[model samples]
Target: MKLAELEVNGVSWSPTKASLPVLHPTTFTVGAGKVLGVVGPNGAGKSTLLRLLYRFQKPQTGYVRVGGQDIWDMPARDAALCIAAVLQEQASAFGLTVREIVRLGRTPHRSHYATSGARDEQVVEHVLGFLNLHPLADRDFGTLSGGERQRVMVARALAQEPQVLVLDEPTNHLDVRHQLEVVSLVQNLGLTIVVSLHDLNLAARVCDDVLILKDGHPQGFGPPQTLLTDSLVSDTFHVDARREQLAPSGASHFSFSLPN
Candidate 1:
C-alpha cells in the first residue's frame, strides 16, 4: 500500500453543542510512512483523537485530511479503503478462522453479494504472511492467546491495503515480549501510523514523533527526544520522571516515581 500523510487541522469534538469538547482543537501531521504516537492519561482524549483519524468520529471544528484530501468529503467507502483501524475493543469473531477474520477487512472493497475475488484472497494471504499469522491461518480465532489475537487484529487491518493505519492501545494487555513484538511490527509496516499508547518508553522507541495530551488538550508535539522531559512528564502524569541511559545499549529510558 502507498503511504499517506495524515493531517489534523484544528480538530475538536464534543458530545453535544453545549457540553465542553472532550478533545480540544488539536493539530499535528504525520509524514508518509512515519509513525506518530499519541500519549496521555485516561480521559485525556487520546482515543477521541484516534477516532477522528480513522473517520469513526467526525471532528466538530476541523478537517481530518489524509494524503491532502479531506476524509469527511470523501465517500465513507473511499475513506475506509485508504484508512484502517484496529481499536481497543474488537468485534467478536466467534467460530471464524484467522484467515476468515482477516478476509473481512476486504469488505470495503467488495459488494454485499460478491464473493472473495482473487485479489481479495491475495491481499489476505499477503497480510497473513506479513504479520506472521500464516501458521495460524486456519486456527479458530477464539482459540488464540491475547497476543496472538492482537496480531490477528493487526493482520486484519493490514488486509485493507490501507495507506494509513490507526491503532488505539495496541499493547494494552500484552506482556513485555508481546509488546516489543507488536511495536517492532508497527515500526516496519512502511505506512503512515497513528497509534495511542500509554507506555511512554515504548512510544519513545517506536514513534517518529509524539503528541502529548492532557485533559483533552495538547501539551506538546515534537520529536520525543526533546519533547518528553522530566518536567513535562511530571506535569502531565503527576509523577516524578527521570531520564536514564541503559548501560548495554545506552538507550534513553524513563523512570517514574510517585511525587512526595
Candidate 2:
C-alpha cells in the first residue's frame, strides 16, 4: 500500500428515484496516509457512503475521487487495485479455509482466465504472517471465533495491497481486546484508511480526522479533539458526553449519560 489521497465532494444518495435521500450532500477529504473515521447513527448512510468510496455504489449527485481519479470513471478492476474495502459482513466459512479467503484478495490483480501466480502467493503469505493469521491459514474460516473472523476479514483486505482501504464497522461484534487490537493494527498499517465506527471513544483514538454524519448530512468535520465537543455529542448523538484525560499519556477518554 502506498500513500493516497481521498476526496468526497458533496455526495448524496437515494435508494429509489422517488425516495428521500439517504445521504444529504456532504464532503470531506483525507490526506495521504491519514485515517478518517465516519461516525453516525443507524441509516445515517455511513455504509452507503463507503460503498461509493470503494465503487460499489455511485453517488446520485456528487462523486468520489481517489488519488486524483474519479472512482466511478475508473474501471472496476482498476478501482480495486487502488482501493479495497471490508464491510460489516463476513464471508461464510462453509467450505473455504482462511488462506483461501485471503488469497481471494488477488482477484483484482488477475486477468481473465488467469490463475494465481507466484507473486500472488507471496503476497497472501506475507499478509497472513503480518496479521498473525498464519496459524489459522489451514483452519476452516467458519470455525474461528468472532474476533478471529474479523481479523481474517481484515487480512483479506490487506492482502489486496491497496493504497486506500475502506472498512465499515470493522470493530463490530468484537470484545474489548480484539476491538483495540483491530484499531491498533489498522493504525499501524502504513496506508490510508476510511472506516466507519459506532464507538465515539474508539473513533477519537483511531481517527486523525472525523466526519460526523447525522441523517445523511455532515454535522461536523475536523480533528476529533476539535469536532467531538460536549454540545456536538449531546445535540447530534443525544448523549451527555464527558471528556476526561487519562494518565501521563494525556490521551482523551470519555463517558456518557443518557439525557434525562
Candidate 3:
C-alpha cells in the first residue's frame, strides 16, 4: 500500500449539541510512513482524536485529511480503502477461524455480489504469514490468547492494504513480551500509523513523534525525546515521573510514583 500523510486541522467533537466538546480543536500531522503516538490519561480524549482520524466519527469544527483530501468528503468505502483501524475492543468472531476473520478485511475492496477472488485470498494469506499467524490460521479466533488475538486483529487490518493504520490501545492487556512484540511490529510496518498508548515508555521508544492530551486539550506535540519531560509527565498524568537511560541501549525510560 502507498503511504499517505494524515492531517487533523482544528478538529473538535462532542457527543450532542448541548454537551461540551469532548475534544477541543486539535491539530497535528503525521508524515507519510511516520508513526505518531497519542498518549494521555484515561478520558483525556486520545481515543476521541483517533476516532476522528479513522473517520469513525465526524468532527464538528474541522477537517480530517488523508493525502491532502478531506476524508469526510470521500465515500465510506473509499475511506476504508485508504485507512484501516484496529480498535481497542475486540470483535466477536462467532466461531470463525483465523483465516476467515482475516478474510473479512477484504470486504471494502469487494463488490456486494463479488465472491472472494484470487487476489483477496493471496492478500489474506500474505497478511497471516506477515503477522506469523499461519500456525493458528485454522484455529477458532475465540480460542486464542489475548496476545494472539491482538495479532490476529492486526493481521486483519493489514489485509486491507491501507495507506494509513490507526490502532487504539493495541497493547492493552498483553504481557511485557507481547507488548514489546506489538511495538516492534508497528515500528517496522512502513505505513503512516496513529496509535494511542497508555505506556509512555513504549510511546517514546516506538513513536517518531508524540501528541500529549489532557482533559480533551492538547498539552504538547513534538518528538518524544524533546517533549516528554519530567515536568510535563507529572502535570499531565498526575504522577511523579523519573526519566532514566538504559545501560547498553541508552534508550529513554520512565518510572512513576503516586504523587505525595
Candidate 4:
C-alpha cells in the first residue's frame, strides 16, 4: 500500500457567522503509519478539521495534501482511492445488511450499478474478518447495537483498502469496553490515520501525535506525552487534570477533576 504523509498547509476556514472561524491557519502533518489524534472539547474545530482532511469542506485558504499532491486537485474517485472516512453525520443504512454496508466501500471501484465482483466480495469478507464481524455479517445493520454499527462503518471504510483512514469520533455512543476495542482496532490498522477524539486518555494511548485545538485556533502539537500537559489540558479543556505514566508501558494517562 502507498501510504503517504497527510499534510495541511496553513488551512483556515471561516464559518457562515462572519466573525467566527472554525479553523484558523492551522497546519499539521500525519506521517505514514502514524495515528494523529485531533483532541479538544466540543466546538473546538476538531470535526471541521476532519472534514477538511477528507475533502468534505474546503478551507477558505490553504490546502490538504496527501503524498505531496494537493487533494483538491485530484479527481473525486482518485481521492477516494487514497482516503477513506467514517464520519459522524453519515446517513443510516436502515435496510442494508452488515455485509452490504461494508460492500459500499467498493463503490468507487465500480460502475454506476455499484455491484461487487468476486474480488470485491473477497475484500468485504476480509474486512469482516479483520473486524471480527463474520457473526453479524448477515444481520440487518439497523438492528445492531451502536458499537456494532460503528464497527460496520469502519469495515466499510476498510473495504476501500485505503492508504489513509480518517475517522471522526469513532467511539461515540459506545460503552467503555467498546470504546477501547474501537481504538485498539484502529491502532492495529497500520495506516496513516487522523481521528478526532474527545477522550484525552484514549488519545494519549492510541495517538502517535496529538494536535490540540481550542476555539478554532491551533493550541499545540506533539507526542501526547509531551503536549498533553496539565497546563495545556486545563487551559484548553477547562478541567484540572493530572498526568501519570502507566506502570508498564510508560504510556501517559490523565485524571481530571473539575475546579470547585
Where model 2 places Cα greater than 4 Å from the true spot, the runs are none
Query: lDDT score, residue 186, model 4?
Result: 88
Which stretch of 10 consecutive residues in model 3 shows the poorest summed lDDT? 180-189
Q: Residue 117 deviation, candidate 2, in Å?
A: 0.6
Ranking by TM-score: 1, 3, 2, 4
Candidate 1 lDDT over 1-260, as tens digits, reads: 88889988999999999999999999999999999999999999999999888998999999999889999999999999889999888778879999999999999999777999999999998999888899999999999988899999988888888999999999988898988889888988999999999999999999999999999999999999999999998899999999898999978999999999
Candidate 3 collision pairs: none
lDDT tens digits, residues 1-260, model 4? Answer: 56789988899887674767878999888998899999998998998888888888988889999989898899899889889999876587879999989999999888778668999999999999999999999998889988888888989998888888999999988899889789888888899999999899889889999999999999999998788889999999898988988889877778999977
Sequence-dependent TM-score of model 4 = 0.95
Candidate models: Cα lDDT each: 0.93, 0.89, 0.94, 0.89
Q: Backbone clashes in each candidate structure, one number apiece?
A: 0, 0, 0, 0
Candidate 3 has an lDDT of 0.94
Q: Once model 1 is optimally superposed onto the true structure by TM-score, how far is the C-alpha of residue 108 displaced, in angstroms?
A: 0.8
Q: Candidate 4: misplaced stretches above 4 Å? A: 16-18
Q: Is candidate 2 or candidate 3 better by lDDT?
A: 3
How well does model 2 score by local distance difference test? 0.89
